[model samples]
Target: MNETHAIAGVPMRWVGPLRMSGNVASTETEVPLATYESPLWPSVRRGAKLSMMVENGISATLVDDRMTRSVLVKADDAHNAYLAALDVAAQLEELRAIVRKCSRFTELVALRHEITANLLFLRFEFTTGDASGHNMATLAADALLTHILQSVPGITYGSISGNYCTDKKATAINGILGRGKNVVTELLLPRDVVHRYLHTSAAAIAELNVNKNLIGTLLAGGIRSANAHYANMLLAFYLATGQDAANIVEGSQGVTVAEDRDGDLYFSCTLPNLIVGSVGNGKGLDFVEENLTRLGCRAEREPGENARRLAVIAAATVLCGELSLLAAQTNPGELMRAHVHLERKSTSTTVGGW
Candidate 1:
C-alpha cells in the first residue's frame, strides 16, 4: 500500500492521484484530474485556482450575503391580514435595525409577503456574513416573530418554517427567486483539448447534453435541474470543506448548458442554491480549516466575501467534473470500466470488459 500524506505547501492529505516518477511517487496531483489519474480515479477526489477564478465573477448586488426566511402567521380575517401586513411593512425599518441588535453578524436586507384568506407568509432576506446563514436567518426571524407577536394585533404565530424559505428540499422558488450563492461557471475548451483530454468532440458532447440532460430530465420529471451527477461533485466538495452536506438537495438544483461554439466546446453550470461558508459551523475542524485556507477562501478582506469565493470555486469544480463525466459517457463502457479498474477490489479482470 502507498502512503498518503499532505502535499507540500498545500493543506490536503494524499487521498489519491499522486504524480509519479519512475517507480516512486513524488507530488500529489489535484482533484478531478486525480479522479482520472490516480488508481483510485474511480473513487474520486477533487477545487479552485486561477484558471477557475478567471471564469468566476462575484455578483456585486450583495448576492452572496443574502439569506431568506418565510414566517406564517394566522390572522382573524382578511381585514386582519391586511392590517397585519401594514404593521409588518411599517416596522420594516425597525426590524432591520432589530436584526443588528439581535444578531451580531446578521443584517436585514429585505422583507416581502404573500396574503391568503387569513394567512400571512412574510418572507425575510438578510446578509448573514461569513456563515451559510440558515441559522442566522432563523435567529433573525425569531427576533422578528417575537416583535410581531407583541406588536401586531389579532394575529397568532403559525410556523417559523413555512416552506416559503424553502430549506433543504428542492423547490421552484429557490430556482426562480434565488437562494444561497448564485454561481455560473463556463469553459471554452479547445477542439484539440476536447478530443485529447476529454476523449470526445465538441458537437458530440453538446448533442449528448441536449438529449441526456434536457430531454431525458424532462421525461423523468426532474425538479428544477437537468444535469449529470452534480450532487456527486457537490457532496465531495462539501465534505472536504465542512459545509452543510444536506444542502446538496437544493445545491444540486441547477442547469447544465453545453454548446459547440465554432470548434471549441462551451460548457457551463449555473447553480443557484450553493450554500457554503468559510466560517461558522464545521470550519473549526483542523482538516476543514486547512482545506479552506489552501483554497484561499479564508480571506480577511470582508465578512461574506470569503464565502463568495468558496462558492465560485465550487461552481468551477462542478463544471470540471461535469464536463469530464459527460465526455466519458460518450464512449461505451468507459465510465464503468474506470469504476471496475479503480473501485472494485476483486481479482477477476473480466468485469466491465476490462
Candidate 2:
C-alpha cells in the first residue's frame, strides 16, 4: 500500500442514497451515499438546504473504455477491409455467444472497426458487470480474435491492443464516445440559499466558471476539459472506496458547468469516465469493506446493481466537493487558509498570507 496520510478535517457529508433510477446498463441498485468530509460543508449544506432531489442516470456500454484493448488485423489486400467488415458483421451473434462462453457477466455491446493502410482494427465494446471489467473485456476480445483469424479469409493477426481503446489515458475519444459509467449530477440552488449558504450569488459562480474553467482552460491550451481540481475529490474518493487509483487519469477528464437561472444557481458535473465498482479486489479489504458498508453499498443485490450504485454516489460526492472548493476559491484567502489549517503539519495560522 502506498503511504496513506489522513487529510483530517476534510468534512464528509451523506447527501443521498435517494431514489435514483434510469437507463443504466448495470442493474438498478440504489445505494445510500456519503462523501469524504470537508471543511466547506457549510456552503455545501446551504445548497442542499432547499428541498431538492438529486437525480442520477446511468448508461451502461460494454466497452471497457478504461481497459478496452483492440485487435489490429492486416488484410492481405486493402479491398479485404469490406469483406472482413462484412464477415465481422455477419458473425455478430456468434461473437456475442463467444463472449457469453468466456464470461458470465459480460455482454457484447457493439463491434467497431477502423481502417489504416492495409490494417484493420476491430474494437469491441461490452457491458462488464459490477467490476470495472478491464480484464473481462480483454479476455473476451482474445477469444473473438482467435475465431476471426481461423474463419475469416485474407487477414493476418495484429497486436492485441491497438491503442484505440485509449485505456487509462486522457484522450478526446473517451469524452466523445464515452468510457465508464457516464454520470451526470445536477442541482439547482435557490437564490436565498445561495447567498445564505454559499455566501455568493449565482452570477458570481457562473462568471467564475466562464472566466476560470472555460476561457482560462482555452488560454492555457487544456484539451477537452474545463475544471479546477476534480482530481482532488476523485483521488480522495477512489482511495477511500478501494478504486484503482490509476484510473483517475481518464476519470478526471470532465467538465463542470454553472448557469445563473434567474436568481438560482444551476450547477452540474458530467463525468464521462467514472470507473468504480462495489465488488472487486480491494473492496474485500477490511477498511474498504467497512467504508462500502457505511455508504450502504455493501448490501447484496443483483450482479451489476451494486457497482452502478457506487458509481452514482461517487459522482454525487464529486459534485459536492467540487462545488465547495470552487466556492472557497472564489474568496481570496479562504483557499490557502483552509489548506494550511486542514492539510499542513504545523499548526501555523499564517502561510505567506494565511
Candidate 3:
C-alpha cells in the first residue's frame, strides 16, 4: 500500500479592516475568506465598510464557551440508570481531578445527562484552552467513563458518543444549551449611512428582516435558525482558517435581528455555536498557521484568550455577510443582478462594479 497527499485550493481574500470592540478583542483587521462563491468577498466588504462608519463598529461580545463530549452507559434497568446519574452528579470534584490527569488544558467545567429506559447519556463539558476541545473533551470523557463503570454498579459501557453532545448536527439542544463559543455581534448604523452604503433605508431593512427572515424561516420549519445565508459566510471563513468545516451545521444555526431604532438601523447576528480554535489538528498547515497569525488569533495571551478572539472574529464576519445579503434582498432584482454580473463567465466583471 502507498500513501499520498494533496491540497485543494479555495480562492481566498481579505475582506475588511472591520472595526471590532468587545471583551475578547478590540482592533481593526481584515478577515480572510476562502470560497468558490465570488460575490461573498465584495458582499462582506460592504458590511465591513458600514462597520467603520458606525460609532463602535461591531461590538462582538463572547457570552460563553465550552466543548462537549457525551458518553453512553447502559444500566441493568431504568432504576439503575437513574441511580448512576445521581452518583455521578455527587462526584463533580472527583471528575474534575480526573480530567486534570488527561490534559493540562482540559478542565471539567460542567456535566449534563439524559436517561431513557436503561440507557444513560452523560455529557461532559470542558474548557480546552486554545484548542477547539473536541479531542481534549473526548479524552477526558473516556477517562471519566472508565471510572464511572468501575465505581458505579450495574452499568456497562455503551458508546463514547451518545448523540446528546450533538456534534456537527443541527439540533435544538445545541442552541438551547450551547456546545461552542457563543458570540453576539451588533452594529448600529445611522439612517443615512444605511441608505448610502447598503442602498436601503433603515426601516425597510428592519421590516424585511421580520417578514422575510423571521416569518419565512418559521413557515419553512427551520429549527433554531433565522438568517439569509450564515452557512455561506461560515463555510468561507471556516475553510480559510482551518476549522472543522462540518461544524458549520450547528454554527449556521443563528438568529439575525434587525431593529429600526427610531430612524437608525440596529442590526445584530447571534451565533451560539461557533466552534473554532487557534491551536488544533487542522491548524498545523502553513496556510492555516499564516491565516491564524494574520487574524491575531495566534497570540501570547491567557489560556483561552486566543480561541475566544477567534470565535468573536468569526461572529463579526458572519454579521458582515448577513447584513450585506439582507440589504441586497431589500431591493427587487438587486440580488439576482449582482449574482448574474459577478458569476457569469462570459461577461468580464470587476470587484469595483460590485
TM-score of each candidate? 0.81, 0.81, 0.97
The most accurate candidate by TM-score is 3
Which tens-of-lDDT digit does each residue in 235-312 have in candidate 1? 777877888889999999989999998878877788988898888898887878877886667856568777876776
Q: Between candidates 1 and 3, which one is better according to lDDT?
A: 3
Model 3 lDDT per residue over 1-354, tens place = 798889999999998979999998898989999999988988999888889887678999999999999999999899999999999999999999999999999999999999999999999989999998888998999999999989988899999999999899999988988989999999999888887777788899999999988999999999899998999999999999999999999999999999999889999999999999899899999999999999999888989999999999999999999999999888888888888878875354333234
- Arranged by lDDT, best first: 3, 1, 2
Q: How close is candidate 2 to the true structure, as a TM-score?
A: 0.81
Candidate 1 Cα errors over 4 Å, as ranges: 1-65, 345-354
Model 3 pairs whose backbones collide: 16-30
Instruction: Report the error of model 3 at residue 135, Å.
Output: 0.7
The residue-by-residue lDDT of candidate 2 on 273-298, one tens digit each, is 88887776667767678878876677
TM-score of 1: 0.81
Collision pairs in model 1: none
